[model samples]
Target: MSDYLRLENVSKTFGGIRAVNDVSFALKQGEIVGLIGPNGAGKTTLVNVITGVHPASLGRVIFQGEEVTRQKPFQAARRGLARTFQIVQPFPEMTVLDNVAAGALFGGSPEGLAEAREHAHRHLAFVGLDPIADQPAASLTLPNRKRLELAKSLAMNPKVLMLDEVNAGLNTGEIDTALDLIRRISERGITILLIEHLMKVVMSVSQRLLVLHHGALIAEGEPQKVVNDQHVVEAYLGEKFAKRLKEMGHA
Candidate 1:
């Protein structure tokens, strides 16, 4: 399969500390991939580099058969690449519908207002937030805020969408909603790269898993296998926790 997005030896450093260390990965069209690691594992930094929020210390970012390592964020968005923040970013003063409509208007789609509103409505319904569409984006609860974020990102109509910890701050019920929405997104033929914390979501949704630690990839494989791998266990899960997970048959 052709890669919809590729990162080659991408590295980002701050002073003497390397936040991302020569990381490399490729995401194919219509695939959902998971990236996870302990705190400060360089996951967010990598996303920043790919989205051009930070320049790669050394490497290239390729999308749609073209090199876009230094391209601006808006440039990447026009090339069918878009991302969501770990924290929701909404136009607090705007109604949810209008906020999402902005993405439709400017997210590389020149469709008219009716078409854009039609598109945003489809995405809002997909996220189960249609009932609250007329409300202010900031007025929604935390889970709904996340839904709105996903909706806004979806409004952009990206081929490859990168999410930074979409499930980080949710309760079980909220997390469930987020997981289901993510599945629905994949069903729409949108490829996803998720940097997530909650293990249940990761193991449940990811086809392939990549583990990072201290700015380096230490494991990549089937979720269960990688989680139980000795090095991965030691690096992230403590020995006791790893063994207990094995005994419980989750590792």
Candidate 2:
């Protein structure tokens, strides 16, 4: 099967600084890939380039066999790509359902408000936010707000979903809940690229792992192999983590 998404020699620069440099990878359809790196690893910058929040300074971003390197954010959305921010940004004044409905109305192909809302309701249910649908978005807890973000993105009917640190501030139970939701999403045939700091969460959910350091691709492979790689250890995981992993028999 063809790659569902491909980044070829992709680079993004802000003035003289290269936020993403010479990074390339392919995401197969229906696969869950994890992207992990330390702070300032350019992970979010790479996501911005892929989602068209920032255009690449060089190279190509191909999606579903088409070149979308310079597409605008709305254009990318229309082409069935969706992303959730690390910081959830809901329309505070709107009801949870309405906020999600807006995504269906604009990002997807819903015909009218009624259809959009119906789609939104289903998405909210999928993300376990249906009970709070009528509540104000601002009233939600952090975990609920994260679910709201996922619901809003799902309402877009995206073929590829890019999630940025969706489990950042959650407790163990909340992270498990998020992991289950992510698994359900992948089971529905949506290709996922997840950027997360939680090692256990990423290790458990991702079929493959991609590591970035100093704006470049450091490693990419099966989760276990990639985590145990010497370069990956030195670049991101550090020696202490490697020793701990070996002690835990993960080596």
Candidate 3:
């Protein structure tokens, strides 16, 4: 696979606090990347930087061989970079179909809506949301609403899709649905950058894992290896996590 998205020497600060500190990584075409970190670890900040929600304080964002640093959200969308928020925002008044259709209509091309809707329908199907096509987006359950979020982002036809906690607030069954959706998405050739706390979800869905702590990458590797790394264990599990893991035969 070729490089689809790249972030180099990226940094962001709020006053004196560095939200992201010299973070750099490259995402390959069609690779599902798991971006993991504890709260306030700047995982979401990195996502926002790439999506143009918050411009990078320093560094460059390259997409498809071109520099896109500081580009507007709409401009990035036009260039096939789309992201789903941690908070689901839907037009409560609009039907599921219409809500997703708007993504294709606005984010992609006016001419793309008709085509985008067809694609949207398939994507909704991929996310297991087709059965409620005519229902108002606000009426769905939380898990399905998350699916709608994925569908809406899919409708944008992004080359690099950034998903922030798409699996949060889900039950076991709902998480199964989310995993299936993510698997199908990767199968369809959409490169993904997911920031999730669910170890099960990230372990199963991502092809590679990038672990961040305090806005800097500390580990990068296959999921299993990274999970057991001393630094990774410390980041997720407190100081005694190693001993706990040994008691459970994980160490």
Candidate 4:
């Protein structure tokens, strides 16, 4: 695998506070990389910087060897950097198909609405939401709504998909289904950056892991190794537990 997306010394500041601090990493093509951190660790901020929701205060974002640090959200999508929001917010009044069609039309750069809707149908089927394509987005259950979100991103023909807390509100069975969907999506050659809190989900799905704390990249390596790092364990389990693990030679 080769580097598909690279961030060089990325940092983001909100007023006087730094939300993302000199963070740098790369996503290799056709790999699923998990980004884990405690709440307020600026994981989403890093994603925003990559997707152009918030331009990085310093450093660069390179995609397929091209610099895109200043691109807007729409431009990010058009460049095949698609993402799902932690909060699923589809247009309530529109049919689910139309909502996904909007992504295809606006970001996928299809020739017209007819071609966009065609792409939407294909994506709906991919996410197992084809049966509910005509229903209003507001009517679906939470798990189905989450699947709809995946469909919308897929409709954009993403090369890299940043999933922010996609399993946040899912039940065990729903998460299993989602895991399967993610694997299937990966099979299509889309690189994934999964920002998740669920250890089970992240550890199981990720090929590699990146741990962030206090807006900095603290650990990056294989999942088990990263999870056991002193800084990562300390960030999640507090210094006492981390010290205990160190004493036990588990850190």
Q: Among these predicted structures, which one has the highest TM-score?
A: 2
Candidate 2 Cα outliers beyond 4 Å, as residue runs: none
Writing each residue's lDDT as its tens digit, candidate 1 over 108-146 gives 685687788888888899888898889988798888888
Give the candidate order by descending TM-score: 2, 4, 1, 3
Which runs in model 1 stand beyond 4 Å of their true positions?
Answer: 112-114
Clashes of each: 0, 0, 0, 0
TM-score of each: 0.93, 0.97, 0.91, 0.94
lDDT of each: 0.85, 0.92, 0.85, 0.91
Model with the higher TM-score, candidate 2 or 4: 2
**Model 3 regions lying over 4 Å from their true place:** 110-116, 239-251
Q: Pick the candidate with the highest lDDT.
A: 2
What C-alpha RMSD separates each model from the true structure? Answer: 1.7, 1.1, 2.2, 2.8
Those runs of model 4 whose alpha carbons end farther than 4 Å from true positions after fitting are: 237-251
**Model 2 score (lDDT):** 0.92
Q: Please give me the total number of clashing residue pairs in predicted model 1.
A: 0
- Residue 183 in model 4: lDDT: 92
Collision pairs in model 2: none
